[model samples]
Target: MVNGPAGRPARSLTQTLPDGVRRTTLPSGLRVITEAIPTTRSAALGVWVGIGSRDEAPAMSGASHFLEHLLFKGTHKRTALQISAEIEAVGGETNAFTTKEYTCYYARVLDSDLPLAVDVLVDAVADSILDPADVETERGVILEEIAMHEDEPGDEVHDVFAEAIYGNHPLGRLISGTPESVTPMTRTQINNFYRKRYKAPEIVIAAAGNLDHATVVRLVRKALAGTPLDTGAAGPAQPRAGDKRVRVQKPHTVVLHRDTEQAHIVLGGVGLSRYDDRRFALGVLNNILGGGMSSRLFQEIREKRGLAYSVYSYAAQYADSGLFGVYAGCAPGKAGEVLDLIRQELERVASSGITAEELVRGKGMVKGSYVLGLEDTGSRMSRLAKSELLHGHLMSVDELLGRVDAVTIADVEKVAGDLLAHRHSLAVVGPFDEGAFPPG
Candidate 1:
């Protein structure tokens, strides 16, 4: 286990952001970040394109995601099977994903295979074959994937919440486009879309774990050498947020449809975006509210009142928008009461300022988590790339910890008050009644 600042071992495989991670950018617009650690024998490599669902236009809602799938089907020198076999043969794992604001392809491999990993990833993105047959099969696979997401209630409601919060913006759309759009996407459309977005200079390559920085950069540059120059054009911006309330009515009230003998519910509201200066304070409020077992939501709702088995609150920070959320699973009959309890806690926390003890705990948790992230190379690379994309610079560990530490009780109270105000939005799944939820 990797040790944190307080000397306790961390549980997450991707914890700890390394100070050794060096960052640089190529003239072609590719950001290069590297971390070298002696504790682990493996390394993680990734290329993060600063574009995602939000960047696509109405005519190409799922093109970014479709391109991600096509990249893995095959490249100029390797078949899809060959790419998979090569990575697995080296005891490495490779995959890619598309998010609202970014798309990334990554590999975690033995240190010796770092060069080979770089080659595979660079080729996959820069020189994909996008085979016609594979494209057809992937369309079917992605549609099924979309269906799978709908089948999971907890997952579906947040998508619903996103729709409610962001309205008709591209941000509200699913990362994977609809069955209708993806199924009918043609090869020419894919190629044209790829040329316009995928080759942007805003792409970033990041790596963490044991490796040589110069060697890794060299490998990346060499693999992608012959690729055409990036056009240097930024993608379109995401839509802004507004006061919008939308209720999606699917069949089945008290959708206690699942027989797990319990109901899952998620409550969320417009939180704070990445560039929002109050984000650090909101993070503190989240910690005190439901970020951990000792948090107020867990203590009062579960440990003290025995309302449910699990409870937590968190904030998802995006480039232009963010979400403050609370999630819990309770006995079917107690679901409505649990919602009341959560609101009550929100009101109480907002009106009555946090205690000194709570402040300490929240700060400690946030700082501790930040310190622990420096241990893995992949995390280091991800942090650099994400910070660059989201904040436009690399934030040192000390700087982040300072921000978390600087949060005051008043800061926490103010954010809680702002978040819990009537401007909030929510989504629920389970044996729930819409009447029971707090209205915006």
Candidate 2:
């Protein structure tokens, strides 16, 4: 059971073994969460703001991503070069990224240097001046980024698939908007966005590794002193829902011809949302189907048949909805055969489901990967931040492992049928856009 936030001096959310996490909300509505890891020498800290690409409107399509780049260009307190240089001088790593539901500015440094990290990350996220000249310069950089996204077949097909399956919803659009959308995004619009969305209540400050909860709280307080984020009254925004819940549409098989010799294709269907309890079972089923080197898809498509050099399956979980799909990059001539085989595999899984042996192997694979991924301070820090920002709760590693182990063959079979029996979508990028994408 978890304690409520009302009266406890510290909001102790979840604790496991040698580590425990605590949360405290400042008067300005800022939520600070920290995990004390006494053994590690490094710490990771991030400021997570709840606005992301999905929250943008038609005109401000790429504003969130744009701000991600522009914010580092310069803040009122430090120039862009000085910002990176200062962190580099301390042997720390700093970076930021924008996602569909939130954006995070993070830093990794020696535990002794935690103050520098907090100071810099806070300045970058909260004090960016949004200079006009810097905006114009980054515009070209963003344009090139958009151009770069166009050239990568493997990456572009997934976005095309999203547009096909999710329709015109913001979730379906590229995180980096088109050149047209980004080129004209002015400083005023972006500045206003930063002011409106980057509020205290909508943000979370999280730290992990060799840190004191009270010390982290003090550092964040000292860093934000007079900023609006130091004081606000709204509760955290509700997890993104609505259209995301009922947003998927008819299946689509879209093809965009390119001069590339290899064809990149994504075969996917609407998947269970982050809130779905079936996710644990689905994780095991995905492992057997295409998650690793020993999985069915990689074995059949790449090893046994040599149809593709790279083949794997993945699941993208979002707040209210998600996507499950397989990606195969193969020679243009093998596109048709690859698609056929993929469909056959889906049909087979949807019918008979995985075997008992597969169930054990899948569970082992998932649990092993889960445990191994958290071995680093950075990964642990990310885990804590994401749990707070996205899920709004923490599940201890043991509890998670237990859930993974509890999934039976029946659970996997039911989820396999439930997700795979639906109308799946396909997106292909090849030299034969005219003839490559086949009818459903």
> Which candidate has the highest lDDT of all?
2
Residue by residue across 1-440, what tens digits does model 1's lDDT show? 22245544332122233465665555455656777776789998888887788878777779899999888998779999998999999889999889988899999999988999998888888888788899898888888889998778767766766666666678678888888778778988988878777763557788888888778777877887776533232332222332343332221212324444566766666777777789888877788899889999999899998989888997877766677778888887887788778878887887887998998999898888877876676676677777756565567788888888889988888887787755345566655555545452
lDDT by residue (222-306, candidate 2, tens digit) is 9897655655344555555534355687886888888998999999888877888899998998899998999999998999999
* Shift in Å, residue 196, candidate 1: 0.7
Which 10 consecutive residues of model 2 have the lowest summed lDDT?
Answer: 9-18
Give the Å error, residue 277, model 2: 0.5
- Report the number of the highest-TM-score candidate: 2
lDDT of 1: 0.75
Q: What is the C-alpha RMSD of each candidate to the true structure, in Å?
A: 8.9, 3.2
